[model samples]
Target: MKKRTMRWASAGLVLSLFLASLSFVPSGSGNASAATSKSMAALYAQIQNERAAKVVALVNKERAAAGLKPLTVHTNLSKMAKDKAIDMFKNKYFSHTSPLYGSPFDMMDAYNITYRYAGENIAKGQKSAEEVVEDWMNSPGHKANMMNANYNLIGVGYYNGYWVQEFIGK
Candidate 1:
């Protein structure tokens, strides 16, 4: 097991270096920026409006389940969330070993997922964001990792069809 892990570690290091090099290469910067903006615009709008409430609720719910006190939008947690994300990015496993480095945008995705679900629950008259998070933690697809030292729970989003994808890409 030790030998296997070492081999995987070396491979991951090589891959990360390769990807980092690729990301630094100059290749029509404007196109990439435009494409990213176009792809992310809808998601941005969704999160700001509809999904924001749900995500806040989900995080609050998870906090409650972990025996931590619940937080709110106006809570100190809103600012602390970004701090936690930076800490996650600095973890040795991510900074040294994993080829897939965590990014703020990725953290935002998790936030949006939680917020969207929480908002939906509110609309359905499910008052407890903590309950929503607890149910999600018990869900089949939730994955736990040591990387989540600060931000414990992150949501997984599913796509039902290609319509949204096509719309976003176009």
Candidate 2:
């Protein structure tokens, strides 16, 4: 019985060592793979590309509706359309009486207003993303109002028959 116990213990030790050795050794495959994680710049670039693609799709849909060829979408949307858009966003969505400084920006297809910029803010004069979000939050009376209302505003955009939105810090 003692001899049998010793054998079993030895076998267990051998199995554990084999597993530990396997983890320490590099893969047998000759080729190395891309890094599993990306830098902040890479991540931002990827997101920018994704966002641009969505914008393009929405713009193309609008052009098709107008019987025009597909063209690239730019930030330089006509002032009339842009102003009307900002108004529709505030009045129809939030029912705000006063002009909103910044809420999320959005684009809509021809059928109706179906797309938004999700978490992106539309602060008129704020330059950076941080300022756009923070300035709006800390604006005079906004903090108190938002805290009382218990809801942070965000945009909801869509692309290619699917809803797309990004999460931004509150």
Candidate 3:
């Protein structure tokens, strides 16, 4: 029984060593692979930007129907919203407040965004920008943020299945 146990241990050690060594192996494509990865990353960023823009447009349409002025997209606020979405997706939590980043206002402060009035809306599992915006508009709290005349700046972020919208006004 002891000998059998020893053999099993030896086999486990060998397997571990083999797996560890695999990490050191070169992929052969090297710089070409890295360049491709960079290009793919840029393409993905562009797609995400487009999706975010679509969300803004849809939100603006909703506001227009309600006779509210369209909110301009704030770049810093967008960065903050994107960071929140990424944080929520990575940490697997969906809420206006994040364990890592605190509330939306906190995130805005971190991004150096100043506003006298601000609001945030978050959603998950929506397949498209329209769907997510519709979901938000259906919710009273989110709809208020969307239609609030006090808000003059907007930021949107979509990552994976998570969506975040930040609203701000002077």
Quote the positional error of residue 118 for candidate 1 in Å: 23
- Stretches of candidate 3 off by over 4 Å are 1-30
The alpha-carbon deviation from the true structure for residue 1 of candidate 1, after best TM-score superposition, in angstroms, is 38
lDDT of 1 by residue, 1-170 (tens): 99999999999999999988756736556566567778798785454333335645555555566665444343222332433323434442222112342443343344443322211111112234334344545644321211122343332221211000000000
Q: Model 3 clash pairs?
A: none
Prediction-by-prediction clash tally = 8, 1, 0
Give the runs in model 2 whose Cα sits over 4 Å from its true position: 1-38, 73-170
State candidate 3's TM-score.
0.81
Residue 36 of model 3, lDDT score: 74
lDDT by residue (tens digit), candidate 3, 1-170: 99999999999999999988755546775666567779999998998899999999999999999999999999989988898899999999999889988888887887889999999999999999989998988899889999999999999988888898999999
Candidate 2 clashes: the total is 1
Q: After superposition, how far is residue 144 of candidate 3 from its true place, in Å?
A: 0.8
RMSD of 1: 17.2
Listing every candidate in turn, what is its Cα RMSD in Å to the true structure after a full C-alpha superposition? Answer: 17.2, 17.0, 4.4
Full ranking by TM-score = 3, 1, 2
